[model samples]
Target: MSSDPLDDVFNLEDRFYTQGYTQGVEDGARAGRIEGRSFGMEKGFEKFLESGRLAGKAIVWANRLPKKTAKQKDASEKSSEACTLPPLPSNPRLEKNVKLAYALVEPDTLSTDNSDEAVQDFDDRVKRAQGKVKIIERMLN
Candidate 1:
């Protein structure tokens, strides 16, 4: 109680400043992480759309599904299995590439929480899938 008013005020100010600075840093870090994730997801989605992987998958799946006869489709009791699965690729290389491409283009693969990592991953996946798709298209053609 040997009152040094200036000392007390300085202590209080220093404490407040330290607390505010720490809180601000934490908040800024959290915000940055959220923004990074959002940016990554948006960019990934754009790449996914531009890649045409989904559309190609749809075409492949549609082609694989068996067509029903008009009369069979009209019957009250429909067949147990609506779509008969197609045979797997007999060519080893083609099968491997097909599997890799499908895996790369999967929904899970398109989303990442890190912007830089996501963009790089997206680029690699897109290139790999596109290459596989080209191979498949050539085979089909």
Candidate 2:
């Protein structure tokens, strides 16, 4: 039966402070998680959009390559065994075209001044890209 009034008061104050500190930490952690998720999703969406644009341009350039002839198709089919793949042509010109096409569409290749821009001034850029694509297409001839 030791009822020390000062000890009770100190215990009460300590308990209240601990409760408040725990709640604050939990609230801060929750907010941080929400912000982190939102930031990640926004960045992911931007990357997805840029990848789509790059793929579209790459597809246009890829279409410039010759289609597989019947003989090539048969060759590919014959090599369709498990873990086996058909070989691509050993043409250095084809390799050069592929590298140039990928370089043209790669996000990393964007100019530093425009890298962080939200909206692109794409009219002139698009025309120049099309001109490059045309040159690559002609190279296939």
Candidate 3:
């Protein structure tokens, strides 16, 4: 069988095109995965930081609340040196709101998974917690 030089020359362009396409696809897939992971980590950190900040506010609010009983007051006094915030006046509604806010942002109970349901729940909880913080701030002022 006689090979044709013209055929080889004609096919060179197609061969190069196929190889380039394959390499491009592989590179795109790898780059896509890296970018996806980086984005996920950045978003995850932002969410968790907000949740933690809310949780810290809840703790401070809880601590500033007036102690209800002698036993509670004594216990709080023992640790009083650690907190400088003046006790908030005893208001049942304010106390309840503070407690609710704490529960909504409690880090231990929140899920860290990236699944749709988990992310939805986390977002819902954070939104509710932010609302509670606003309410508590209004009550304080």
Candidate 4:
């Protein structure tokens, strides 16, 4: 077997090109994976920030509610001691208005019908009755 010096150099260029191509593909995949991970982490951080803000607001509101309710209870107790509760009147208008308001605001009335049309009808009735109550309240005031 005669060894030619030029035979070894013949496929060296093809091998180098193939190796370079494989390395480029691997680098591109690595970059893609890194970018994807970064994007996912960014989304997770945003959700965390939003939830943290909502939790902070909820805590602030929850903390203030007890103080306000306590003040209201104290005021009511003082007023009640000073003046006895007025006897409930047997007025027909008061009864009718209260019954109408109760019917409009009741969960059972609104939720009884599962159909969309029935729900719309219930909503319309509730709104109409609410308007009437507002008018009656204004007249009383």
Candidate 5:
């Protein structure tokens, strides 16, 4: 009756705007939850695949190598050389003395030896050591 059209118009617009804002906020929250769940699922699946691949690789490595005694493995790692178990022969005598010569060629364990004989002995031991390693390598392939 007073012709306060401006007040009515402002009030109606404000109500509409508030309703629109509330709807927008609810829609955004739902969308964010969906995106977050999707991302989490993807990461979990990726980790599962990576772990499966590693397990498979470990199986392959275990199959290729014989069941080495802990002592042999430890000794090999300590000596910085590959330790391998040869095939079991019907006659133990037929098997060559695989560990015939011993000398510390490992740079860490090498002792000071001034004599020529010691040097020659060390060289021959290394050669025999290398031959044994070669035999093991050939069997692996």
Candidate 6:
């Protein structure tokens, strides 16, 4: 027995609709993943760049700190001509802040994982480092 013509026509339309929907879903899923990965990489790069900048500032601050021992002072004085930055006044609090900032954004200490906990920790460290930088700048000015 042959199927009814009208039924076949309706079934054809339904089949085409289903196929189109499936194709669209597959395409969308693929595109979404690509876009998400690209976005994630860009954001990660930006965060790391900022962290590196903060770390660099910490290193410079640490270097510019006055040497403690007589022997150290003599060594720094010899190299002081190469160092354009004037030595930071010997303030215990400033020294502490600089050290803390360096520890916060230190590359070896930070995780590169994409996990939620790792990301959160990275963000927290960066934020703390930023606060330290601001405090150091204010003290300098």
Top candidate on TM-score is 6
- lDDT for model 1, on a 0 to 1 scale? 0.66
Predictions ranked by lDDT, top down? 6, 3, 1, 2, 4, 5
Pairwise TM-score winner, candidates 2 and 5? 2
Query: Which one wins by TM-score: 3 or 5?
Result: 3
lDDT of 1 by residue, 87-140 (tens): 333465655556666776776557555567767887887777777778766764
Cα lDDT tens digits for candidate 5, 79-124: 4444353333333221232222112233334323636775565455
Model 2, residue 31: C-alpha shift (Å): 2.0
lDDT tens per residue, model 6, 23-108:
99999999999999999999999999999999999999999999999999899989998988899999999999999999999999
Q: Per-residue lDDT for 134 in model 5?
A: 55
How many clashes does each candidate structure show, in the order listed?
A: 0, 0, 0, 0, 0, 0
Q: What is the lDDT of residue 115 in candidate 2?
A: 41
Off by over 4 Å in 2: 64-141
Model 3: per-residue Cα lDDT over 19-135, one tens digit each: 999999999999999999999999999999999999999998998988889999889988888877788989999999999999998988999987999999999999999999999
- TM-score of predicted structure 1: 0.45
The alpha-carbon RMSD values of the candidates against the true structure, listed in the order shown, are 9.0, 11.5, 2.0, 14.9, 19.6, 1.3
Q: What's the TM-score of each model vs. the native?
A: 0.45, 0.44, 0.89, 0.36, 0.43, 0.95
Error of 2 at 40 (Å): 1.8
In order, the Cα lDDT scores of the candidates are: 0.66, 0.58, 0.93, 0.56, 0.50, 0.97
lDDT of 4 by residue, 1-141 (tens): 588888869989999999999999999999999999899678646544543443343333222222236777687566556654342344556445545555554544544344778656755765665565565455445
Q: Which 10 consecutive residues of model 4 have the lowest summed lDDT?
A: 59-68
Better of 2 and 4 by TM-score: 2
The pairs that clash in candidate 5 are: none
